[model samples]
Target: MTSTRATVDHYERLAASHDHNWTHSGVFLDWMTSQIVSAASIGATDRVADVGSGTGLFARHIADQVHPAQPILCVDTSRPMLTQIPTSPEPQPVVAPAEEMAEWVTAGGGAGTAGELDVILLKESVHTR
Candidate 1:
């Protein structure tokens, strides 16, 4: 198993360059947007939580698919990655670890139940979870 410390270190190291690479890569951006849009369409009204939401790319793409003003939490352990997310006067970004996600939701008055999500996007970071 990958230790928590190691995982954090790995992500922290990569976070700085992740956004740059993704931003310039058209293929990756297209694929990510497609995936997020598809996921959002299936779970129309529920709040979405994106784990390892690096730079909020997927989260931002799916924002319009959700309710006009519903919340979407973007969780990432790396502050640098979170900082790189494109600014949107619309969707907000939150920086936190994926493992602590349940607490973050409950604190926001959500049910905190597994599979209760209308949409839970793991994206390309599922292996980290």
Candidate 2:
């Protein structure tokens, strides 16, 4: 069996290519953005979580719409992927595994500002878990 650390390292490498592949498809991003925006109203003061936020593409877009008041959390197992996110004043990015998110939720850490997440977006990373 692969060690957890090795698995994480592997994902970090994969993340480097994630944006190149996903962002190239404009249609996919547009569809995803529309869905995310429609489902989680951009202006709503909600606690949102994005799991496997590869390169933070969707998270960044959502943050742009939501702005400073709303809290958005970008969680990903890949450190490299998390680093690529723009250092903007909006959403905050956290390096973590999707399955381990409950710890943060229970402890009220990172993106768990108010309490439980109002919206949790898995995106295309669900099957990986």
Best by TM-score: 2
Error of 1 at 47 (Å): 1.8
Cα lDDT tens digits for candidate 1, 1-129? 123767777777877787666554767666666666664664546667778787777677666544434556676767777877766653446666665676655565335323344666777773444
Give the C-alpha miss distance for residue 32 in model 1, angstroms. Answer: 4.1
Segments of candidate 1 deviating more than 4 angstroms = 1-3, 23-28, 39-45, 64-68, 107-117, 126-129
Candidate 2, residue 115: how far the Cα is off, in Å: 3.2
Return the top candidate by lDDT. 2
Worst 10-residue lDDT window, candidate 1: 108-117
Please count the clashing residue pairs in each candidate, in the order shown: 0, 0
- The Cα error of candidate 1 at residue 82, in Å, is 0.5
Give each prediction's root-mean-square deviation over alpha carbons.
4.5, 3.3
Write down the TM-score of every candidate. Answer: 0.65, 0.75
